[model samples]
Target: MASCAQKLLEIIYNRRSIRKYHRKPIPDDVLKAILEAGRQAPSARNLQPYCFIIVRDQELKKRLIFSEWNRFIEEAPVVIVGCGDSRAKWAVVDVAIALQNMVIAAEALGLGTCWIGHFIEEEVKKLLRIPEHIKVVAMITLGYPAEKPGPRPKKSLEELIRYETYE
Candidate 1:
């Protein structure tokens, strides 16, 4: 069996919010595997109320480049829009968890991914023709990484972690 610690660290540290990507397309099988990982993520009451909109259309992607953070989505081979069913109380939270699962899975598969914030939710909903009943939680650009990001500075354990109680 794989060491859980090693696997977890590998998935967490290896994953980067990639901003640059190769134009080469990802295989359908790889995409399916990533999506399956998301589907398997635990959700509130198992109410996996989320929808994925996979956008590969160049024109549509270009039109989606309205946000500064999402400009790279236009060049990626695939962009996944994670939408939450508004009826579920934990819809956004659940989709966020699922999206993280998908990101880690993509890293394990040697694919690069970046989580794009839903800065223009209303515009994006209209552009994607998504129903009002769905909330656009997040978006992600997926493809082969063009560049590896340098290790970003992180808060030390002492600065971030609190022992039992918040002191």
Candidate 2:
């Protein structure tokens, strides 16, 4: 049997930015697990200054999809909008961590996830009713994948790693 670390590495390597999705609602328990993963992520000074907006309404999702680049928002069964309180100096970093946690959790559960960032901020805020103080960090689409993509190439460890300090 593979160790937990080994299993996690496999999940990390296998994770893909899935956009196409089948029309299947996530089970309540499974969804809860994914949400909990985000909530449990560590935040600076324990403020946990992040919120996940679960958009399941078809009509609203349609409105959120402002362009062809984001059409997956309309097809996904759920879209989680990760917001951060801009008052915190580390808000962006904190929210990003939590969002990644949810993505990893989804991948581990045989679900597909995609991080979407190219959208009109003002329009999104209006559709989601996000407050002025909260910045929309990123949104992720989630569902059963309709397409399976092969692994994309990545930089080797030698090229990416920096020893001790910048070379």
Candidate 3:
């Protein structure tokens, strides 16, 4: 067994952008934990101006996936839509931080998540009846993963790092 910090590091290293998911629905408590993680995320000036929409209805999920690459969203048991207030200066940034927290929390809890950024925002807002004042910043799919993918190649630290200025 690994220590808490070790376990977290392991989870971070192993986390994947899971698209294929099992049909099992996330437990109420687990879902709450995930949401709480997002809620706890820090926002600029402590505004935290964001709303989350939980979608489990098959029809709605089916309608939300507009891209072929994101079609797997319809198969997941849960989808979390992060909406931010356009009036806020850092609305989308706040929502993005929260969404990343949620994704990490889901991974730690034995669930998988995939952050989806491409979609028809207007269509989604119209379908969900989101207020005109709110902006649909991002969407995420959550469920038990059906596939385990190997790690993809990554750039070396030396290649990406610079000392003081552009190298």
- For this target, which candidate reaches the highest lDDT against the unseen true structure? 3
Show the lowest summed lDDT stretch of 10 residues, model 3: 1-10
Clashing residue pairs in candidate 2, if any?
none
**Candidate 1 deviant stretches above 4 angstroms:** 1-5
lDDT to native, each model: 0.90, 0.92, 0.94
lDDT of 1 at 166: 100
* TM-score rank order: 2, 3, 1
**Per-residue lDDT of 90-140 in model 3, one digit per residue for the tens?**
999999999999999999999999999889999999999999999999999
Q: Whose TM-score is greatest here?
A: 2
Candidate 3 regions exceeding 4 Å error are none
TM-scores for all candidates? Answer: 0.93, 0.96, 0.94
Off by over 4 Å in 2: none
Per-residue lDDT tens digits for candidate 1, residues 1-167, read 46988897877986778889999899999999999999999999999999999999999898778767668888799989999999999999999999999999898988899888756899889999999899999988899999899777889999999999997
> Residue 32 CA error for candidate 3 (Å)?
0.4
Supply the global lDDT for candidate 1: 0.90
Q: Of the candidates numbered 1 and 2, which has the greater TM-score value?
A: 2
